[model samples]
Target: MTAMSPTPHDPLGAVLPPSPDNELDTLRELVSSTYLNHDPSLVTIRAGALFARLKALNRAANHATRAHKQATADSRQEMDHTYLGLQNLLYEKRHLEREIDKCRQFASVYQDIPVHALEDFMQIAPEEAPLNSPNAKGAPQLDLKRKELIKEKEALLKESKAQLATVENVKTHIDNLMKTATDVRRKVNDLVQPLPTTSEPGQSTPAS
Candidate 1:
């Protein structure tokens, strides 16, 4: 009967001198068992899941940004409509002022006429002359159309004001989403950066 030599092994990943053949076999079994104990594809699957989630989040952020841009475009269109209102209002106001001037000018002419002349003008009946004269029939309709235009300008101004408010609200929401997305991306970067890269066991870079 022969006594066998005691086998020695390094436990702390220490460099070793020549090891006995039995010890090498034991070390190989230890490595194989450890590898078998954990799932081989778990790391890759988890990394893929993380990337997919980030991609989805980025797409949502892009959509949000587009929606915000659309809101801006809507606001600009509304501003143009407001300018149209203002321009039309100014034009009508000027036209009304001119019409008032014409009315006053005609009234002054009547004032210059003697009272008997005014009485003489009143006695002339249009029906006996021609009531539906080309110029006479259209004045009231023209005045009504101008009044309607003024009212439309006012309504458009009010609508523009409401659109302005909606634009502001959309801008605020977009700002908040951008900030939140930035934070989320930063967190994802931190999580991904610490993952180990494939390399030889002793080939680690020194801590920076």
Candidate 2:
């Protein structure tokens, strides 16, 4: 049923009573969707941040999906429920959406598969916009390079220490060789000296 158009004269506007023709069907459809109407049994088990993220993702995914389907629709303002799923998908690597399981076993697959094209189309330029966001596109590669440099520096430091130790050992060997050479020179000088007593004996013989 068509929604009664808002009129200028009616101070209260088109206050159409909640009927099957208009409001009732809309409510029924909303209730059927897990994102909008959650089962009481499931809500009981909700715990921690993950549960909250899943719920928000479920709702946001639905909003984006619908918005996409109705490409020409001028959706109402203040209808930002779609952001819940989008931000989670954009930031988190993984999440479990309980609502979208009925139709699409994996409801929040968008989180895993970032919609870079959509984000670009929407001109969303935040760092966490999507995997394809220019800001984050090269970060993972840079991180890998940084890790490799750290490893290389550590290896070089180890090699330098080994080289220094070898140089010290060589110096010690050279000092020992120098001491041995000095002792040999002193001993040769002592053996080559002439005897002083021989001169006195020769002089006495000449006199006789």
Candidate 3:
């Protein structure tokens, strides 16, 4: 029998010692009894069991992968929602800040202007009726009072004018009466005076 030379690719042959006859016989007997003469039905049953176990593991791995993906998606969605909410809040904060800044600017610009309490303003300001509210109770009262004052003033003026006319008439009548009395007195004095005696071209001496 010719011995086959070890090939270059046979790494085990280079390191291992030569097998004894007893070891070689034991190996051959194990192969023939366990593998070569094994039952076909038993091998098929074991293979089926192994294949079913592999399929179950594969299914478990797929389910775990799907669950992980779903969890990641939900987490990402939650993060996005939180980010949007934060952005909205930040925008509102900025808007409020701008409004506050404008208010401050306005206040600074008008700082020198005087401010009055509501009560003080109410006290000093003129009372005006509300627009388009002619039927308001207070407005009607004020209008009535003003009308009454105007009517009273007019009545007073008319009375004064009539009194002035009456006074003028009395003064004219008094002046006429005074003139007539003076004329009567002058005529009585003239009539009461003795007539001047005149002697025609004669000198008469009378003792009185």
Candidate 4:
């Protein structure tokens, strides 16, 4: 006996259950068989079912395509945003590195310069009187003091000059007196010289 092929209603060869992998082939065979059997009612019913299935499949495919396109666009936008963020980070890192390098250079250049602590500097620095204080000497007071000191110095200088001039006059008078005494002594010596006696011929002299 010959074996019979499976029909649409008995698609498993009457021994096994139908599988999803062969469903399209089974449908094709069913369509062909219906046309070959020339049954109008069966053809009309199967055609309607096939058309509905095709429409459902088309709708599902269109939805999947739209979802895929939307997902791709979203992924691309996210990637762009991430790339921009990375670029910004890199730029900031470079700027920071440059700033650090400049700081290092400055440190090396000024290495030998002294750096005083704030407390030490403050301790050594001169303190100013408060502006609001009643007795605080302002610029006008300082100027007045300076003028007084200058006037005193000028008076002292003039007095010193006068004293110097007096000392010079005294010295000149002493020098003139010394010269006059020398002249007088010379005149007295001339006047007091003993008369050279011509008693050499007489041969007589008075004893003192």
List per-candidate RMSD values in Å: 21.4, 55.7, 65.9, 62.2
Quality of model 3 by C-alpha lDDT: 0.46
lDDT at 116, model 1: 27
| Candidate 2 residue pairs in backbone clash | none
Among the numbered candidates, top lDDT falls to 4
TM-score of 4: 0.41
Each candidate: what lDDT?
0.45, 0.40, 0.46, 0.47
Model 2 lDDT per residue over 1-208, tens place: 1223443222121332222223323434444655346765554444223334434444544443343334212221112333343344433322222222222442332335433343353476655557566856665665566566658756655655555555455455545544544443343333233212212111333565
- Per-residue lDDT value at 189 in model 4: 41
What order do you get sorting by lDDT, best first? 4, 3, 1, 2
Worst window of 10 by summed lDDT in candidate 4:
193-202
Tens digits of per-residue lDDT for model 3, 128-184: 834345444355565566566668756655665665565555456545555554554
Which runs in model 4 stand beyond 4 Å of their true positions?
A: 1-27, 33-35, 108-110, 113-208
Q: What is the lDDT of residue 35 in candidate 2?
A: 39
Q: Please write out the lDDT profile of model 4 over residues 97-173, one tens digit for every residue.
A: 55545544443323354444434544665677354455442545655655666686566556656655655554565
Candidate 3 accuracy as TM-score: 0.36
Worst 10 residues of 3 by lDDT: 10-19
C-alpha TM-scores of all predictions: 0.35, 0.30, 0.36, 0.41
